[model samples]
Target chain A: MAEETSPRGPERRRGDALLRAIHEAALAELAEVGLGQLSMEGIARRAATAKTVLYRRWSTPHELLVDALHQAHPVEVPTPSADDLRTDLVAALKLLTDWMGTPAAGAVLAVMTERHRYPELAEALYSRVFDPRGGTFTSTVLRHYANAGTLDPRRLTPIVTQIGEALVFKLTLDLNRLPTDEELVAIVDEALLPALGFPLG
Target chain B: MAEETSPRGPERRRGDALLRAIHEAALAELAEVGLGQLSMEGIARRAATAKTVLYRRWSTPHELLVDALHQAHPVEVPTPSADDLRTDLVAALKLLTDWMGTPAAGAVLAVMTERHRYPELAEALYSRVFDPRGGTFTSTVLRHYANAGTLDPRRLTPIVTQIGEALVFKLTLDLNRLPTDEELVAIVDEALLPALGFPLG
Candidate 1:
């Protein structure tokens, strides 16, 4: 812990601030060098911290990455005002899109794209980051609505839970851009809502 | 064209046979070296043909790669038996999964994954491969059913057309394997069917 204290005196990063910087650095390093080349040395260098400091917290780059991803993963707040399923679902996906704009999202993509080459990393990401946070993007909102007796729980199947994130990923991959507000609404109207037992007539 | 005659006597690749070989080689080469490093030299070497032979049919690797993808892209066949939408939709996604198992699929993914770095190649993929083939996997089936008056044409929105492929991609990414037949059926029943106005009671 001696090297944890920066030589730069008053500008030294510590506590939650230091953890956040380290997490950000890990993600940035991953984006720059990819999963194969990600190392504690590189992350430490990027964070302007000593390898000893990283070693104190995480045994390997994989562990540090899992921590970073979990720390950065956004927990969706399902605000079901007046029992509004559509608005809440849209807001959940909006949280997802907003997260997609962050550096952490890019890092997550890098890990996922190379998941086959590194199975343990992908597994750790799910257990540490995604699953603990309530599965996919719109899943929390769906569950909230279901619990409120507004939406059918049976309709909240695995396929239904994944619809929002799946479509978001598909649109992003196809368009090479985040889906627009209008497009998000269309996903809600055309896809998500109907799957929840609300047919389009 | 003189060098088009193989030095290996009776094993000479020429005409359509030669063209097919060249296309396959281009896709294989792209898979091996990726888009940035793809070259006529590598493709010709892999195809066991001269660079001159390659240049005779196509000017550059991009042109040759596009041709390869177009040649390999699968056309969905919708057999609407007794006006059945479920069977046709399932078969369409089956075609998609089958295509996903091919080398061409890998080559297409390679291009798409790095689409930003190689925008022109990505654009060529859509124009020459996807759009020309019928937009997406389930779209053709949806249209066929729509024309037969079995499905509501208005229900065939972009979001609806994408549900099958999107769910497939999502499942594959999350599970690190292609969706099983059971999973595909789930997608159709729980997501696609409902979205197309066939909600489960």
Candidate 2:
């Protein structure tokens, strides 16, 4: 699989292939043995690569696992052209629910729970994964609503963010179930809309 | 401290003393070292007892820590004789805020998060610590309000429970700040009351 003859040259191709192999191997290991059981030695063995190669790129298992998670759930910036706040929020929430409801994401959360025992790992995960994805989208949608004069501009961010965070918490920690369509609707109608100063009859 | 010392026997006092020592030591260790570092051996050492003594009553660290939590935040059954549902709920929320705001209670929550990794421990915490205590008061307040024609009766429990859970999550996980008195009032008035069909101005 080495692209030695490619126009981009052998070095770039070799690096790309190595990263891909390591990432896939890490994911497969995560699925089979869980995060607590994941190790660089195990991942290198699974990928048919030496442990030195794995350590050269990533210093710790936490860093490697985080990179794998990023690959699995690539960040998508939400454009606020959906006409209304509720529609935009529903779309954003759907995106969040879909990503979090997956088995891989569940494993990620399990790892995160364990990661909390290590504060540095917890901080890394929060900054790299949690905040940028969900937090950004929620804030952007609320800002758009506030700009449009529909929402109370002052409390918009905190309110919408709280609702979104609550939903995520419910899925990950409380109910351990996916958010149903009905729940999505209730959240938007009963919780988010009111907080945004919209009247929902 | 054994309470087994009856008027005719000395056995009762010995049992009571042992239990007291164990309980006090557990609390002290939790406060000083936190949940992550809590261990049965540590508790035994602090209590001036042997590890075998702790193991005789509790099989695992999780069980001992959970029991300690239960003893700390025991279920409080509310007597809702107040005419206004708002007043009763406000009183209950105040109590909840005070309990959750304390450092000791926060330490108990630190242990609860660890319980998430162990499902059985999570279930036990939910049933013993969560549901019986605050859950009962919340349900009673909602039922009383609905019956008195102050709010809608259908699905009141779930709605109120969600709001309460959200508040707790906000304090413990997200914002990491206790809900202010004003914020608590706003939550009850804006979210809980309106969702239960109470008209909010």
Candidate 3:
């Protein structure tokens, strides 16, 4: 225990801190000039670290962005409690908008554009980001309701899991702006819940 | 009857034919090179028509494209039959996918990118393209079902009208490709219909 804490423990903590700084810098730069114009030297200069460290860790900005996007917290999507359908949907969609609004709009666009040039990156984003965060939440929440007989068992399918996330992504990308709270509420109350067979009071 | 067959009537028919030729040329060119790089000269060359005619009718490619996007349709969205929600959603989504796949994707991107530079153009596309087609279909169809007691009356709202259209526009933009038939059916059956509270069985 003594040796564990004495030297390398503090060094490990410093290494993690440096990595965070580099990732933050990379995201900031991506938001500014976009993916095509991004440079390792520029990120290094902005990060105040050696260029060698960035090159060693990531051979390309695309690789670095895949890592950086994970840390950028567009917003946190939480698993639903056994709440009723309306409240559960509202809560889920709210998290989506929060994430949409968190990053600079340019940051998202840059990644979207890069995905066209790089298929592996697109697949990575789907696996790492899209699926884990929003995918399971809907199923878990809906299953809870289904078990209670609030929703039909057949309604608990892949479609239920994707509607809110798809809407948020679609609205943000199409409108080229994040939806306001009023818009989000209307989307949930007027559309999402009713479709899920949750008769609104 | 004699007046209907006058020389002027034949001239008007030719004029309409010319207009269609121009619109076709514009869409073809837009599909090839996209909105940004599209030129009147290029469209004229492709259509085997004169540049002066294009200039006289529509001064810019943007104006030409605005007209062309309206005409390039495999089918129009009709009011939903009371047959079932699954068929109605699939039909609506099919129309959406056709539109997305029509013009070269660059055409959509060009206009989307231009929305920031020209708010008036964005407003024009919304008023002319989006609202008339997808917007009205949802309300008209939902009201059709609701009147028959197949769907809840409250499900008839602007958000309900828009969810499938929103999802299609969003997926095409984000993925940079249109969804296939099987995927489209899955989206409609698995998600769209169920969300509207339509019983799957």
Question: What lDDT would each prediction earn against the true structure?
Answer: 0.83, 0.66, 0.65
In angstroms, the error of model 2 at B21 is: 4.3
The candidates score, on chain A by TM-score, as follows 0.79, 0.74, 0.73
In candidate 1, position A76 carries an lDDT of: 50
Q: What ranges in model 3 sit over 4 Å off?
A: A1-21, A32-57, A73-75, A104-114, A126-137, A147-150, A173-176, B1-89, B109-154, B169-177, B180-201
* Candidate 2 global lDDT: 0.66
Error (Å) of candidate 1 at residue B54 is 9.6
Poorly placed runs, candidate 1 (over 4 Å): A1-26, A29-67, A74-82, B1-71, B74-82
Poorest 10 consecutive residues of model 2 chain B by lDDT?
Answer: B4-13
lDDT of 1 by residue, A1-201 (tens): 365556557686688998999999999887666665689999999998899999999999999999998888774555555567888788878888987878888878867866765779888987777775545558877877788888879888888899999999889998899999999999999999999988765
lDDT of 2 by residue, A1-201 (tens): 684455474343257787887887887776565555678998989987889988898998778977877776665656777787778887777766777656456556545544434567567767777766545556777777778887666665343356665655654455556677667767777766655555456
Compare candidates 1 and 3 on DockQ and give the better one.
Answer: 1
lDDT: the better of candidates 2 and 3: 2
- Which docking band does candidate 3 fall into? incorrect
> On a 0 to 100 scale, what is the lDDT of residue B52 in model 1?
97
2 or 3, which is superior by DockQ?
3
Model 3 clash pairs are A74-A99, A75-A99, A195-B195, A195-B196, A195-B197, A196-B195
